[model samples]
Target: MNLTQNRTRIIEVLIGILATQLIVFGLAIYMFNEPTRIVEAQGEILNVQLDDAMTLYAQNCSVCHGLAGEGIGATPALDSDALRTMDYNDLEKVIARGRFNTAMPAWSKEDGGPLSDYQISELVALIQSGDWIETQDRVVNLGLAPLIPFTTDPNPALLAEIGNLPDGATLQAAVQLFAANCVACHGADGLGTGIAPAVNDPLVREKTADELNRTVTLGSPGTLMAGWANVLTTEDINALVTLIQRWDEVPAGILPAPNVPIPVTEESLALGGQLFSQNCSRCHGPEGQGTQRAPALNVKSFLTDTSDLAIQQIVTQGVPGTAMPAWGDRMTESDIQAIVGFVRQWEPTAPEVATPTRGGGGGPPWLRNNTTTTQGTGQQSTTGQGQGQGQGQGQGQAAQTTTQPNWWEIIDWRILLLAIGALSIAFTLIFMGVESLKARARPAPTEDKSQE
Candidate 1:
């Protein structure tokens, strides 16, 4: 019995020691991973912010700033090293309040613009990251065309001749500026439209720089030509004047193509859903249910009355004097078509949305999983073996796939540690109880007194 008891005590001590080692190992792992986990969490948060900021940029800033923050026309590039290294507060303030007497509008809600303080902060962080390539990638994935970089160099002789220009203004700058702001009304190459006279005409070329500048700055009364004095800087006016005076010298400017009907396909619809969520969802709502900012596009009335072409037109040209800004410059014609197609899909069984609600509630931007939600059915169907085949509820189609979650990824380490500790204790107690029962069942070992 003494021998048996000694053996049992040894086994219990070994088990206890094993349990302690396991607990120590778990603690070590937790301690080592805590900093890593914090970093991962922070990275995930930044990624979400970046995604939101990317969408906001594509919708609001990309029109003038360019898709990759490479700058368009007179708009300054945000992808510069200087900008990335700029003070956060200064950058945030600039984004919120905008620059004085420039095209940059005050974006903060406090300043009567669309974005909130939190949104601006996200944008600031995104800009500071200098991840324009990622931004461009996301934009392209959303079906928008990538911004074409200007590879054409300006003639130095023309630069010398055109004095009193903006600090960084060049002949190329004039061409880009014209293409961006002038193409709609003035026609390509200043060919003129019914509403506006041709600035590239020989008669106009005969005018002096000062004369052209005056005409550009001040409005032609009772004419469609509005004064740009309030809108454009004096230097910008000079660049336009120079272009008009030297039209033959200026290189041919390419304008955005007119909208063409895009054939609706599953692929296009999927792409369209993504585009709408990224670009239109903030105002139009995720399901197009409308919000305080924009009207519900998924309603029976709106969808029925509005043709696909009409929707495309509205999306392209945008409604003037309202919150809508023209997307023709920012988005490709095909991209607009896809969005229109997606909107048109709702017409078949469009629901009447009487009340407007706040948009955006699918899941955390970083928590993308292969989970598809069937439309009109409260069923979730996951397709494909990997993570790419899921139809995200409000996220449209999945753009990319993620790795499958491992056991470690799925479980909370702390809980697992607690469970391990509890099991160890329970196991010890159970083993001791079993041993006690066996000891109780065994008759007391009687001392054999045969030798005595």
Candidate 2:
């Protein structure tokens, strides 16, 4: 009878323990599982979108706008107070339609560019995110100037009088013309600025008035100097030349020429390629194919007509009254020569020519289109054979379509640790309950009283 009662007592205790566990498990599910699952799922989706956006930006936008959204040559900075304060819809429209008569191209696929609607939204989200906004705020507050100065439009009033200047124009008129049109690139005194070379340089002064006239009239092709023949009359061009020649009397320091001549070797060519990609590719296309902002260097006509000395001069002493900045201040003479060596390889008669990679260089691999070709028998193939090959190709293509698993597929380590801890606690309580029940069921040490 006592055994029967003890068995019932143990069963009841075990049931109560299980009931407590059930209640605790219910509470844990309510607290940690339901609410958190929704939030974690949403977070994973957001993270994936953000990653996609960053990749797209690097592939498409970074070339002109910089890797960090700071603008390059002639490109306005995206991460600025102006952009931050802009309405989201307006920003989206700019990315979709682009600015008129500017270097900024429409990026949306619908508008004839590569990106999709969803991708555009992701870029917008990225731009408006707190991190990017904070970066812009910091950059602005720091008052640091951009490496490449922004290009501004010449005054309309001044541009209208381009070909209408009077004969024997005075120095004051020339000064006003320089200030109104060329001051942004060339300095106020016609000395070099961040943008262009000094007009007072000895090499420039040495050029005869006729050579200067031709230069000013026809402009330098493949560089930023636009021909003033259409814009200025012959008299105006002559006056401009006269004013530039007068600078020779000022006795300013002359810019140095390259001490080390560039050697055209394989190693130099490779280094030149790297340097061009880092510096020139942003404005000029990756293979010098050209963009709306810069002229193509690889064109047959340009390569054929341009001379090595001319190329070297342009690289060293940038053209005045243009967006081309004087690179001599920033790069060593040897480095510039190395770049020149690389550029010369694109000449029309060169042994080998380079082709621009689609989407240009430094873009994501997925953006590149893969072309595959198959070999077949010279005789016409049977329909059955063709169908079989098509099926095999389809299967191979399907296999290639598999993508990497997203963050949501992976379990969180923190959640796993918490589950492990909870399980350990539950096991400990079960063991303790069993021990208590065993103690209750075990007979007391009454046998020790028999010894007494």
**Would you estimate the TM-scores of all the predictions?**
0.41, 0.33
RMSD to the hidden true structure, all candidates: 15.8, 19.2
Instruction: Report clash pairs, candidate 2.
Output: none
Clashes of each: 0, 0
Report the C-alpha lDDT of model 2 over 302-352, residue by residue, as the tens digit.
Answer: 666666545766987887788777887776544565577777776644323
Which 10 residues in a row give candidate 2 its minimum summed lDDT?
Answer: 383-392
User: Which of the numbered candidates is closest to the native, going by highest TM-score?
Assistant: 1
lDDT of 1 by residue, 15-106 (tens): 77767867776786687577656656666666667767876675556545776788866779989889889999999999887776655667
Off by over 4 Å in 2: 6-10, 19-23, 26-30, 33-48, 63-67, 71-76, 81-90, 99-104, 130-452
